[model samples]
Target: MSGKDKPKSAPDVPGATKAVRKLGDELAEARQLHRLLVDPLLNTVRAERLRVSVTRSLWFFLACGLGFTTAGVQAFLADGYTTADPQWWAAWLVEPAFAGILITLLRWEAEMLARRLEVTAAVVRKLKRLLLFSTLVMNVIPTVRPPDGHSFNLGNLFVHIVIPLIVFFLAEVMPVVQEMCTRAKDTATVPAAPDVDLDQQTDEPPADIVRPAVAPVVPSVKLPPTVMTQVRTTLDSVRSEGRTPNVADIAKVVALPDNLARQLLADLTPVNGHTVPNI
Candidate 1:
């Protein structure tokens, strides 16, 4: 039939429109949950970000510390360490320096304790937003005329405003901060799957399919008491670190030379719920 002769399409029916809206809502909800899983705000990401926020935002912390320390240094330089001029370093630390020192110590402690990867992600996100708005307001400060008809100096512009703006941008690049942005974007999107042709069968097996097999049982192998204790300790350590205990860790635990440890591991069928290496 000619194109013109084809039947004209009908307008949307009430039932079909309702179905479409329902589908869209469901899709939106699914996308929200998917994004939450992909990028949680208060999980390990937050902990990690919190841990690095001080170090990553170094310039801000350093400046604050210096401002506080400057007064003390100046006092020391004034000379004459009498009762009036105390030389105590601790006494010299002021409010600004105290904040910096506290933050530095916290960050250092977290690092030693195995810092979280995104401990400061949320904080950075919020701070970056606040700083961006503040920058806009502050840049206008120099342009405003005083009652005496003189404009303020923006001579310290780069040091005070520009550098901070740059730091805010830098903070946004952190892994946790990026995750929050992605999470926001993801929630706004609808979940969608690619069109699939069910009738089109592929020659290859599905990736998720598992094939079971029967194997001959091997005789049990036993290790000496000392070796068993060492193996247990190594496995425990590996588990605590959230990893599977492999050949290397086992060797370290038992203090067995590499060749012997490897041979012993191979001989065992399974140890402490894990299969021996090379089995």
Candidate 2:
């Protein structure tokens, strides 16, 4: 056929052509939107931002430790070992510093334990909630108020500071701690059982099971002549039908076999009982 005389395909139809173009345009627009959403996550700036955040956190704890340690040691050296110091400034620095170190270590140790247990994330959330409650209680009670010492006023710092800082450290170290704990747990466990002894053979095949032969006692069942004749006729009919009849059917028209129907039926049934009636 000539090209002009040939039938046009669905895409070549005027309405279908417009629908295809519209669908293509929509798909392109959706693809563009997806790219725009994902681009920010893959950007170099975002990667650098994450790196800087982690670095800053490490430095922050290090700085805090150094500051508190320096203050404690300096104050202890400067003034003699009395609670009531003549120099109030040294007392302010020293007491709070000691407290800060103790609190920080407590947090660090608790988090370390949580991480080792592989429950850091769960423990952190619980600890944060607990710390917040503690902070609130401390704020409400004047005697239990936190000491004021550094630029980081821990009086209210307990509310905003320690809990979240501990949580961050816990998050950072948890995976490594969990891995170490898992390794330690595995090492501590008893080893698995070795393979079975292959030299010895198992018992013979199940189908070849050797049962002791017992001479069966044939029951002396004296059937009436009429019943016997009816049985013979029914059996013949069943044989002609090419299927064994059930015990119930035999009982209705004749005498049931002296042997159990299931035992006799198994021998007579065609197609392994599929063609026979079951009683």
Candidate 3:
């Protein structure tokens, strides 16, 4: 076959190559955006939701356990008394009263701990212990005595002992959980500082003139007439006192922030033998 008769290779399409390169660049940007912005936001929201869910679950379980334990205590107290007796009815109120006080104290402690405060009062500790001991005694005494003719119930005794202790420990640990969840939520919700790309920075001097950092001024807002008058009066007084008008003098007189005072002084003062227009 002649060399000229052989099929020639297809020429490279510049447009196809450029389009592929553009698509790759866009994909890379999307990935970068996800990593730098979207992912962190999603993770923070997820963490906040998890904390809320766990906190609610803890409270739900605590309520259920406390309700059951209160019922047990009521049963123990009312065991020997007949339903017709007023004492049997009064027994129901006894455990609930103690439990209510204990719960109130625990809630107070949780609030204090969540605020990073300590409940260091000796009375608080003593009172909490007293309430817990009272419930334990009421619950356990019935199990050991077993109402005369009945045999001692080891299972009843075990439950009565374990449940009260569990309640006590739950009361103790819940405050710590509240504190942790509050702190974690606060940390997650805080805006993160943008990550700086050190590699993109250069040592080369900028072509534009560098200016000293100043507080940004909003164009839509102007200084009040009263404030402008006060500033002008203060400036005149400072000049009369044989002192050069400055930011400190203006700030002291007008109670303005240093940056605002500085901006005001610049605006009101004459420059290069020219009078500045009133603002």
Candidate 4:
């Protein structure tokens, strides 16, 4: 209860408070720099990596489910056959063969859907259903009616039924998942379009100085008076129709080069207090 019994307060080291303040300031600055520079790069990498991880995880689980279903189908097909029989060996391949076709079709469908194509052919739908139904029927038959007078197994039946359905649904849903992931990855990776200010655009030049009568033309060559007159006539006709005479319009009417047409337009139109230079 005396002062000696009380623990001494920790001594304050010189500049400890200032050191802490300096450390906090440095950390704040580092965070700001990280956000400004490192975060964008990390975010892009993370998005692509995350998408790949998700796709791989889906495939891994689907593979496990399919393997389990294939084992069930193998058992059902090999039930009455001896190990030495060729039919017994062949039974192992049935589910995988069906699964291979299903995977191929689903992959093709996924690629097509990712590219925004429709896959509405009745044959494709029928074929997919047929494969799934065949696998389901094969997988569940042995469990539902056990051979050798063995009692029917509820556990085996449950597994046989549920695993095949899971495989079928996984097959059906993988394409959709792939399409969504592809779209999301594309959206994240595509660079944004640069912003434009439409108000700054104008048909007229910014200054009073006249542009060349025909850009990049040899000074030695000049348009004949008849050609100039024809250009003027075309411009007048365009104005009469209540349409602005642009380079394209002038070129179409007079069969002039685009550069010459643009120059001709500039020469023909008067800007503020500026005289048109003779071509």
C-alpha local distance difference test of each model: 0.46, 0.46, 0.69, 0.69
Global lDDT of model 1: 0.46
**TM-score head-to-head 3 vs 4, winner:** 3
Better of 1 and 3 by lDDT: 3
**TM-scores for every predicted model:** 0.27, 0.22, 0.55, 0.54
Decreasing TM-score order of the candidates: 3, 4, 1, 2
RMSD of each: 17.7, 28.7, 14.3, 19.3
Candidate topping TM-score: 3
lDDT of 4 at 56: 78
Q: Candidate 2's residue-wise lDDT over 195-222, tens digit each?
A: 3333344765346555456844332333
State the lDDT at 167 in candidate 1.
37
lDDT of 2: 0.46
Model 3: per-residue Cα lDDT over 1-279, one tens digit each: 897787654334445566687886787787678566634356556766875677677667767766766767776878878989998888789877887898788889877865545678999989988988888888888788877688988998998898888877777777767666544543343334444444456786357735346833422213545445656787888888988898887654344444555666777676895646666
* Model 4 agreement with the true structure over 142-226: per-residue lDDT tens digits: 8888878789889989988888788788877877776665444433332222333344668876696466767634222134454
**Candidate 4: regions farther than 4 A off:** 1-44, 116-118, 190-279
